[model samples]
Target: MRRFKGFVRGVDGLTRDRGGNFAVLFGAVASVLALGVGFAVNISQLYNARSSLQSVVDAAVTSTARDLTLGVIKEADAKASVQAFLDANSAAGILQANQIVLDKLTINRTAKTVQADVHADIGLYFPLFSVGDMQRVTTSTTALYSDKKIEVAMMLDITGSMAPNWRSKTDKIGDLKAAASQTVEDLLKQNRDPGDPRIRVAIVPYAEAVNTGGLADTVFVEAEGGPKVPPPIDTPLSVSVTTATDKCATERKDKDGYADYSSDGPYTLRQDNKGKTYQAKVNRDYRMKVCPTAALVPLTADMSRLLTAIDHFQAAGVTAGGIAVQWGYYMLSPSWRSAIADACLGAGPTNFDQKKVAKIAILMTDGQFNTAFARSRGASRSQDQGQVSRSNAEAICENMKRDGIEVFTIGFDLNDPSMTTTERDQAKSVLKDCSTDDSSSLKHYYEAANGAELSDAFGAITRNIENLTINR
Candidate 1:
């Protein structure tokens, strides 16, 4: 009996030992599984938060780059703008104020590059499982802003056709004026620089001709008969040869005692030698006077007189777009160098600065060179035709460009010659070929059929000018 009881006690002890071992093994396995699951959850949360933060950073950098390109905001503002963008786009509760950091924002003006370094803290999901509170994510981006200056010119067509609907308030001229005024205002607003004149505008108004009413007389000479000559001398030879008998009689004593000499008709001269033969001849007629040459007025920012002059434009005679373009070129020519210098260094308070940058001319035309002023008998021959020839116009453009003056040509409401069936194709060809060397300088060239489209085209050009930026 004693031996049986001892064996039972031993069996009970063994069962207790097995039960304790099983409990210990199960606890260890369960703890390991919990830890693995916690690790996975924390990693996933961190990855997701990091992804969200990266997205915000990318967006901020992109926005800042665009603003910098447009010259709307400076480097300091760019950094601030980026930070603001990140704050607006970041996921809620993830990026705390302390987590967001702008390490560096360097704008290299000479290199035209904007570099930014961003750092953000990613908070851990399970604090008890992690040693540190957060992880750091760094990112950077560089953007370039072009510093090239843009030169532009605006040439308007103000021919006789422009006044077709003169009786109506919505005439073509009126529409053009409105479009031009709006364009000017927009351009001035968009690209305004008090420090540097990054862009300049010159308006050329042409109809049958450009009225150069203010140019120096020396630069333009009127034709006396066949060739242009200098101003006539006011000497005794230039005085009329007709006799003033009544005035001379009061100052002289005559043998016939007559107060005034009376001739039956106009005075005639007769000569006789030894009664052989005598002949009478009439006096020569006076010479015809020539019209003075037209003058050119310099361009200015003053809109009152310019707009008023445009409003009062009267189109008479034919269209000579080429001559008009040439005239536009002349306005910017150094041939007026003396006048330009005088104007710049003159005594007036508003004298132009000689060191100011050169000028530009925008020449626009809707028609081809069809007609010009007719040359009268014995008059100096003008360019065989009144309108400048295509070749001539091209040469003019080249010359102007050589003189540091840029030219932009536009063909409005004209058909392309390349399109065989379209009318006015020849005119289109002329305009298409009439542009400055740089194609982009010709901002907006459209073939509009109506006034609305024309106005839109003008607006488009103006907007382009406004949006142009010089980062330097």
Candidate 2:
């Protein structure tokens, strides 16, 4: 009885001791805190996994939809494709989506819609609060199926500055050819069918004037007389009356006419917008010095000929990049299909609108636009040919953008060997203004200091264009 009472007294003393109370409280709080920290870590892991799964799901569904649009995969096979994609790309265990279910795969031909609903069982790292081992993730993707085609026109500047500069020892034109050829290859690879690709490309090499080649006889209206009197819209005589042999073609200008000479219809190449009766005439000397040797190649999928055209690129003459930009716009315009003949796929889908077809222009130049056949702002600083050419380029870019054609511009070696900060800034500014103002979202303006950067610029443009056409 005495021993039992002693034990009881000891227990009572221990229980009443306040010195050990904090230890018990700390033990309880530490356990709860540990559990909370572990839960947070597990939750964060699940969130990261969910995000990765969303990306994979999006890509898989989009690819499947594209295949469906191309008739490469049927609805029955789409599930297999999606599953294979998921198995292959579970973001390296970030998304352990073990179970996949296709809730819906709707392809409405009449509506031209492709919709997909997919769900996956993503394994959980930690099952919190009696949660299951897996968490369900659902995602959907939709694409508008259309028989949209792609038309691209490369407006290359083969100016004197692009030639092999002995001082810099850089062949700018050679770099351009390589870059352009790669662009062609990339674009052609995007086509589901190579034999009859839905994509077409046109090359317009410009300097002082655009060389229409065979189209010259058919496209141009003759000079009315000598240097004194220009030709009117009527009494055409381009093929019959030219004493000069150079095929350099000039632009049409009328104060009462539109902003730029569109390649759609028969346009009269007048003298200038200075007055109504101005005579439009170019002598032989001007053509020989400024005319580019590279012949124009219209929309052709013939890869061999396309490469050959790039080979034909020879650097000569001054920069009249505006003319090239205008031609690039015209080449894609359906309104000019009558002149294009077999150049563009049937002028179907009607009008020169960019609804069904993606029209792109890649305009690259190495120097300032110092040469202009017209736009001479008489006696004022506006008469600065470089400024005039820059304005014209911006104007053409504006018009093309209005017509839904995306324009990308590049200034290559704009400031050779480094110049004053002000000069460099001006050069960059001009290129910026000429490019599509997608500065923040997608930079349409690029500047290259050397050949490698120029090639990189083309590659960047190619990727963006691919995204715009295929992934959009």
Which tens-of-lDDT digit does each residue in 186-280 have in candidate 1? 54443445444343344556654444443322222222242121112222444412321111000000111111111111112222232222112
For all predicted structures, in order, the TM-scores are: 0.56, 0.77
lDDT, model 2: 0.67
Q: What is the C-alpha lDDT of each candidate?
A: 0.50, 0.67
lDDT at 38, model 2: 73
Which model scores highest in TM-score?
Answer: 2
What TM-score would you give candidate 1 relative to the actual structure? 0.56
lDDT of 2 at 330: 67
Clashes of 2: 1
Clashing pairs in 1: 155-362, 160-315, 212-295, 215-295, 215-296
